[model samples]
Target: MQIGIPKEIKNNENRVAITPAGVINLVHAGQSVAVETRAGVVAGYSDQDYIDAGAIIVDAATAWGQDMVIKVKEPLASEYQYFRPGLILYTYLHLAANRPLTEALLASRVTAIGYETMIAPDGSLPLLTPMSQVAGRMAVQLGSQFLQTQYGGKGVLLGSVPGVAKCHVVIIGGGVVGLNAAKIALGMGAQVTVLDINPKILARIDDEFEGKVQTLFSDHQNLTLAVAAADLVIGAVLIPGAVAPKLVTAAMIRNMAPGSVVVDIPIDQGGIFETTTHATTFADPVYVVDGVIHYAVANIPGAVPKTATDALTAVTIPYAAKIGKLGVTDAAKADRMIFTGVNTYAGELTEQAVAESLNLPFHSLSTRL
Candidate 1:
C-alpha cells in the first residue's frame, strides 16, 4: 500500500498528519510512505528524521499523488486539483461548515473519511479526542489573553488580585473541551460555571470539581443569564459530525457586557454562536462583534504543533495502517468505526448528519459498497 503525508497548508496549521516515528511504524508494516518535504519541520521533525525512518521525501504533487492521503486539516481550495477518483482522503473533514469542500470531494469521487466522525464501539470519538483536549486547554489560555485591556477587553483580570473580585467564566457544553477549560480557569482562581444539556455530565463535572465550579442546565433562560454576567464565555458545544447548535445568539451577544470575550472552540463545525462568521487564523485570531470579542481560531491545536502532532499521530497511525493494509472500502466494511468516518464516497454523502446539515441526499456506506 502507498500512503502519502502532505504538508498542511492551512493558515498556521503546523502539525503534519504523520510523524517520523509514525512513518517508521508504517514502513515496518511493509507499507510505502511518501512525506512532503518540510511537512514535519514545524512539528520539530526534520527531513532527515523522515529519511532515517524509511520515508521518501517528495514534492507536494508526488506526496498527494498516492493511493491514500492522510492530512491534519481538510484539503484547501488549491489542493482540490489533486483530488481524483478512488483516492482515499483521511482527515478532519468538517463538511457541515464548508459546502465548497464538500462539493469538491463528491465531485472528485474521493473516499473521504472524517476523523471527528469516527466513533468507537463505546461511542467515543477516538481520533478527535486528543486534539479536542489540546484545543479545550488552549481555549482558556487564549480567552484569558484576550481579556486584558490591551486587547480591547473590559480589563477584568481572570485571576483577581488581593481584595478584587475574580472574573466570571461561563463555559457552554460540559464535554472534554469545557471541562479542560474549567480546570484551567479554576487553576487561575476565576469563578467558573459550566452549562450542558446532559444532567449526567453536569453531575460528573460537579463531582470532579467538588462543587468548586457551578454547573447549570443549559437552557435559554439559564444561558441568557450566564452569558450576560460572564466576563468570558467559552463556546465548546459539539454534536458529533453535525454543525454546532447556535446556543449563543445575536441577542445574547448584544446583551452581554461590553468587551466580554468569547472563544468558540467548535468553529470548525460551524460555531456555537450566531455571530461566528468565518474562521480566523492565528495571525489575526479575534474579531469584534457587537462590542464583544470573538476568538474562533479553527485549528487551535496547531498553535502547539509539536505536542499536537505527536498526540494526533499516536492515535491516527493505527487507523491509517489498517486502511493502508486493507483498501479504504474493505477497511470501512471491516470496521464499523471506519465506516462511520466515511463522509463521502463515490460521489454520495455517506454521513447522515453531514448530508442533513448541507441539505444533500444521504447514502448509506453499505449501499455504496
Candidate 2:
C-alpha cells in the first residue's frame, strides 16, 4: 500500500499528519510512504528525518497522487483538485458542517474517512481525543490570555491573590474536551463548574474532580445562570458527526458581564455559540461581541504544533498503518471502527449523522460497499 503525507495548508495548522517515526512504522508494516517537502518542518521534523526513516520526499502533487492521502486537517478548496476516484482520504474531516467539501468528495468519488467519526470498542473517538485534549487544555490558556487588560479583558487574574476573588470558569459538556478544560482551569486556581445533560457523565465528573468542580445539569435555566455568572465560559460541546448544538444563545451572551470571555472549542462544527458566525484563525482569534470577548479559533491545538503533532501521530499512526496494510475495503470489513469512519464512498454519503446534518440523503456504508 502507498500512503501520502501532505503538509497541512490550513491557516496556522503546522502539525503534520505523520511523524518520521510514524513513517518508519508504516515502512516496517510493508507500506510505502511519500511525504511532501517540508511537511514536518514546522512540527520540528526535517525532511532529512523522514528520509532517514525510509520515506520518500516528493512534491505535493506526487504525494497527493498516492493511493491514500493522510492529512492533519480537512482539504481546503484549493486542494480539492487532487481529489479523484478511488483515492482514500484519511483525515479529521468535519464534513457535517462542511457542505462544500462533503459534496466535493461525493462528486469525486473519493473514499473519505473522518478521524473524528471513527469509534473505538468503548465508543471513544481515539483519533479525535488527542487533539480534543490539546484543544481543551489550550482553551483555558487562551481564555486566560484574552482575559488580560491588554487584550481588552476584565483585568482579573485567573488565580487571583489572597485579597482578590478567583475567576469563575464554566465549561459546557462533560466529554474529553470539557474534562481537560476543567483540569487546566482548576490547576490555575479558578473556580470551575461543568455542565452536561447526561447524569452519568456529570457523576463521572463529580467523582473525577472530587468536589473541587461543581457539576450542573445543562438545561436552559442552569445554562442561563452559569453563563451570566461566568468570568470565563468554555463551550466544549460535540455531537460526533453532526453540527454542534447552539448551546450559548445571544441573550445569554448579552447577559454576561462586559469583560467576560467565551471560548468555543467546537467551532469546527459550526460552533456552540449563536454569536460565532464564522471561524477565526490564530492570526485573529478573538472578537468583541456586545463588549464581551468571543474566542472561536477552529484549531486551538495548532498553536502548539510541536506537542500536538507528536501526540496526534502517536495515536493516528497505528490506524493509518492498519488501513495502509489492508486497504480501505479489507480494513473496513475487518474493523467496525473503520466502517464507522467512512463518510463517503463511491459517490455516496455513507455517514448517516453527517448526511442528516447537511439535510442530504444518507446511505449506509454496507450499501455503498
lDDT of each: 0.93, 0.93
For model 1, residues 1-369, the per-residue Cα lDDT tens digits are 899999999999999999889998899888999999999998999999999999999999999999999999999999999999999999999999889999999999999999999999988899999998999888888988989999999988899998999999999999888999999999999999999999999999999999999999999999999999999999988888898898899999999988999999999999999998988999999999999999989999999999999999999998888998888889999999899999999998999999999999999889878
Please report how far candidate 1 places residue 139 from its true position, in Å: 0.5
Among all windows of 10 consecutive residues in model 2, the one with the lowest summed lDDT is 360-369
Candidate 1: where are CA atoms >4 Å away? none
lDDT of 2 at 245: 96
Where model 2 places Cα greater than 4 Å from the true spot, the runs are none
